[model samples]
Target: MQLSFETDVEAFRAEFAAFLDEHLPRGAESLERPRSTAHIPEWARRWQRLLFDEGWLLPGNPPEFGGRDASLLQQYVHLEELARRRIYHSFNPQGLGIIAASLLSFGTEEQKHRWAVPVLRAEKTAALGMSEPGAGSDLASLRTRAVLEGDRFRVNGQKVWTSGAHDADFILTFVRTDPDAPKHKGISVLIIPTDTPGVTRRPFGSLIGPADLDFNEVFFENAEVPAENLVGELNQGWTVANGSLGHERTLLWLGFAERLEDLTQDFRPDGVLGRDRYATLVMDLQALRLMGSAALARAARGEQDVAALSVLKLFGSEAVQSATEAALETAGPDALAHPARTAPFNPMTLEDFYAGWFERYARSFSGTIAGGASEIQRTIIAERVLGLPRG
Candidate 1:
């Protein structure tokens, strides 16, 4: 099936494209991806601020929240353009995308103005504090403890895979307030300032490479946070946590589809194996696009198809992984070389396409596991969509 936007949406897309062209020049100078939140250059900061000021940061949000309250189709077109051009409006995804969204959904008016506003304006950065050593997929089993005092909560625990924590202004942390309660209960979210006493952030690398300082291990020992910093009601953190992930998972399929489409444009048939794989990858990309379009249409009509969303999320991420892996294999022994010594990662140019395939392949694994793992999606689809019994 063909998916095309209406004339008004097409006009909106053109207007946004012009704005991007005027601001983002494709000349001698280009901005490389920042190493970490702390390493963002002044130019990048200015760029993000400009996007916010111009109401292009988040088209779906209201004007005060760095958006113009754009319609659903407009937002879809906006995302499509950004992804197609590989432009990131915000360098801090966990902050602007997940944390700020959560605050908007569940934060008090004071919290929204105090924390979320600055983040939307690019004046502050945040890191999500979830997923400890023992609790990655099964997040409810987290062991971090926070004991409330008269006016503050003294926290003591470790949080692993806290992305961009070292340089972030604060961490939107999830901690257990009552150990006696069930695993899912007695949990709460706290807006913990990174500079608070007894707070330590150790930046680390991922499978992407040692130079990629995107993840951190944060340790909070006797860290005292104000009681007012609590997000949502006490022992209702599961709700906030679900809302955070829901925000993240929403519309992610568009990005997945965009990246795969970009890669497909540069893929070349090596031999019979390459031809077969390329054909399969193309078909999968088309299927993902159709599914994403259908999901978007359903959303515009105010419908919530959780099972369809589960399938789209699971299929889109895995399709990207499969395509990138195939491209790397098609490049043969060349992909075996050390990634650092190879060409920089730029899918826009064919010269660096195969050279960057290994890096892309390495990073694809994270997408499958990020918002929620593939296993989690499969279980949801089975139990809810297929009406299968949980084993």
Candidate 2:
């Protein structure tokens, strides 16, 4: 697809560059990766608050919701600039991008005002409680139970891989509201305050040290949530959950793809791989970008091509992984001295950008795992896009 932008977008890009230059927080001079930013860095949080105040945070949103109502292409350019510069902008990905964006489409005015807007401005933070110990890829099988009593729902269950529950103001939890109904149909979503009486959190430990408890295990011991906290119709959380994941899968990788391309350009591969490996990496990166841009353009036009998105996710993620592997090969024995894992909440350092090679590589796994696992994405492409029958 031929992608073109108006002159105004150029103006917007210039403004964004100026603002980013002027507003970036201290200690933000390094080249950042997607995992380093899964949880927004401290300086980035400062930057986002500024963006929110200036009505540039969510570019496509309206003024009241802290957006510029910018076009998709404008937002695309905005994101591209961020990726190019390795700047992080979100406070929490689930709150600011996925849940709140989904709320714009599926929530009531009150819900939007109470939760979504604060989330946009970073005044309030939220986490998604979707995956359970036994329910990673099969999210609908979650066994968390919620029983309505009077005007509140008493929630009782555990959520694993629930990122940021330790610090999030609220958890957008999925619970079984009606056990007798079909597993998917009986499910419902609730915005439960993390400080609720019966709620508790345990941070997952890093095998090395200082893990991003951003990925957490939360327990609700009959925790109470107001009926008003329920988002969307009861027993219709599958739809709401899908809406959130749609935003995540579609937008989260834009920065990653852009960064991969950038890194490839800067990469000085030598030894066994050399230019042959570098050339192939560049070609793969460009192909991934083309598919991603086309899918994003279609999304901008209110179109959904499940297969196209699946292709973007699958190829984009693998391309990044491959690129990282190439970078690692170049790093050679130096990789042995580098950190093995990237913490979910900390910012990356550019001083020795390649010094922490494995972290970036290991971090790429989340991109494939979250929203939807790469395996599931391939299945979606096969069944929905290629017109294959379910096995």
RMSD for all candidates, in order, please.
2.6, 3.7
Per-model TM-score on C-alpha atoms:
0.93, 0.89
C-alpha RMSD of candidate 2: 3.7
lDDT of 2 by residue, 1-391 (tens): 4666678988998998898788766544423433321345444555677788897787888988878889877888888887777655674877887878888878889999988887887777788889999888998888999999999999999999887777788888899999999877899999888889999988675423475345788999979889988889989999998888877776666755775766665565654347888888778877877777778778888897777877878877777787777766777876556653443323432323334656666666776777788999889988988889998
Identify the candidate with maximal lDDT: 1
lDDT of 2: 0.76
Off by over 4 Å in 2: 1-3, 27-45, 207-212, 269-272, 329-332, 339-355
Tell me the tens digit of each residue's lDDT in model 1 across 10-128.
Answer: 99899999999899734334436466753444566677788888889898899888889999889989988887777777778788889999999999999999999888887888999
- Model 1: lDDT equals 0.84
Q: Model 1 off-target regions past 4 Å?
A: 25-33, 37-39, 270-273, 337-355
lDDT for position 363 in model 2: 67
